[model samples]
Target: MMTTPARIRVAIQIPPSRADYAAIRRAAAQADALGADAIFNWDHFFPLGKDTSGKHFECWTMLGAWAESTSHAAIGALVSCVAYRNPDLLADMARTVDHVSDGRLILGLGAGFREWEAKEYGFEFGSPAQRVQQLGEALHRIERRMTLLNPGPVRKLPILVAADGAKALRLVARYADIWQTFAEDDAFSEKSRLLDSYCDQLQRDPATIERAVFVDGDPWTVGTRLRERGAGMFTLMTRGPDFNLDGLRRWLAWRDEHNAQASRS
Candidate 1:
């Protein structure tokens, strides 16, 4: 059996964009009070839920705001679109945010999706294959620029890339410090196996790539199982006007239970 790590944490994905700043603020403050490890907002022009142009906050800007509000808990975009900003600019922004957060920033990134959002912003909504191709290149440029930046990052920004595709996994192996995946589905086990296979095929130590999965379903049912399948961290995504603070609290309780159980073993 695998030994449990000492710092098991629960994260809350804060959806500030779709909700009011006051509401998002309340959620962030509450989640921090409730002892969440990290908080995030998705990078997008419009809301992914009910409203399109609703009172949505921008990703980096909101993350900066979140940084100021909460003393504890890491803050980041759930997955920033590498396609939106130039790699150097994105690196600088991430670096700046990292400093602002006092090294509590996670640079979660992925290729641009949502063609409508891109077109509205005048960003090229390229084909899926092209986007994936660009994602790898973007990561390379970002890393290079991060090294060349004036102060360097306050801390090595944890590069969190999403998905379990072969190229995605390879990129994760090559550059990412954290591999984020949506292991909430029924087929999560199969995808987890594929992630391991990719690591093996790339000759990268699977343990080096910290698994960061988005939590779905019952925390009690899925929490420990996810850790067993290779997830080192699980982010609970709470969407809407409420932002589900209660749900995150329950999930935190589950994380504590899982950690306690693992410790006893």
Candidate 2:
């Protein structure tokens, strides 16, 4: 259903937690070298898994470093919480990273969810609706600030919004160039249809907004289903410690084969 970027893209998400920075950096470099379209890290003050007390690294700072280190992959947080910093500040930070990466930065954003992280960092973790509202407001401010910045971004920095609710999907239709969702196949298909409807109401072409999904499992099974549902970008996640990417080759192979078929068609 989408019209642009006909080739399927595969990315790697390296969780910046529970491992050494050296290991994280190596994983990112390897992903970039492996012809991955993008590399991502999550934004969290702490680990989200069972090892809640494990070590973690911040997002944007890591991105700045990755921008300088990796040669070919676009990089960013999978979804940076809008509550953590002022929108203007985040915009400036993104602009700087865009320059650092030579225009390969994706400014992924989301409504803040973790209550405890908010309390720990002294940020206001409002209700779900309130957080989505804040995200909408922040998007406006970020856009405005990007225009007002002295040097400005090297390119029109892509904004990737990760959301599932109707209000957030409405915002995605209005503001997002990329929409990343973690819903299951049925739910994702339903949400994708809802997004298309919202795009029509907003008078925007749905093809302009790329659909991205966090993916795992077999490429020919779950991957094929999501691709059929109009997902163009598949993100494979690797946590810290080992940062295993042994499964990436299979996805890359699938990506190449799929793209080849798409091109011929």
Candidate 3:
């Protein structure tokens, strides 16, 4: 039961798969200019779905570029895999990006689930429980590193945890400023209730954690329903080739209307 905001904010995830670096950069900049609250990219080494071997750029590298290119929207990985890099190094990279963006960066992290990525990169794939445990340790190390780094982060960088499992939810309760997941209908409601229970047990005010979810389909029909289900941040995924903004435009319009109503109230 997080404190609901009057207007729902929207993020757009521009997948780097099968697209040129120039196209990806343009899409991110355009999304920011079009009033996106955040612009995100995934942490996979290869393209997801259809063309697994397609041209795909690295996540953190693109984020660095986005930091300098976008003027308004916060930029980050939709969720970076904890297994991919050393926690301390990840923290430093995030800190640098924060500086580059002038403090507009969200550090989104998760226990990675891609076996191919680990296998190809020579990193340990590990079991789900093991990865979750690693993620917890990584979170602790990241926090410590953020403090130890010279000059430190531009601000107390906001951490977004992407998780749905019970163990991961506990970590989210303990550390996350924003909790993100992809669920809908009854499953979405149930997961949210479980998160609230975790917050209560941890003596945390649920309102302190912002709720986010990935959205597909029409904003007016689907987005409103998700907002009602306690998702304040809605993220839409746009794949490359031609990073479409038509849908994003419609959602931004919805956001504007919703916020205006809130102001009146």
What lDDT does model 3 reach?
A: 0.90
Please, what are the lDDT tens digits per residue for candidate 2 over residues 60-138? Answer: 9999999999999899998999999999999999999999999999999999778988899889888999999999999
Tens-digit per-residue lDDT, 80-191, candidate 3? 9989999999999999999999999999999998887789989998899999999999999999999899989888999999999999999999999999997786788888
**Residue 244, model 2, lDDT:** 86
Q: List candidate 3 stretches off by more than 4 Å.
A: 1-3
Cα displacement (angstroms), candidate 3, residue 244, comes to 0.9
Which candidate number maximizes lDDT? 2
Q: Residue-wise lDDT of candidate 1 within 20-57, one digit each (tens)?
A: 78988888888888989888888988888656877777
- lDDT of candidate model 1 versus the reference: 0.80
Report, for every candidate in turn, its global Cα lDDT versus the true structure.
Answer: 0.80, 0.91, 0.90
- Taking all chains together, each candidate's TM-score versus the true structure is 0.91, 0.97, 0.97
Error of 3 at 17 (Å): 1.7
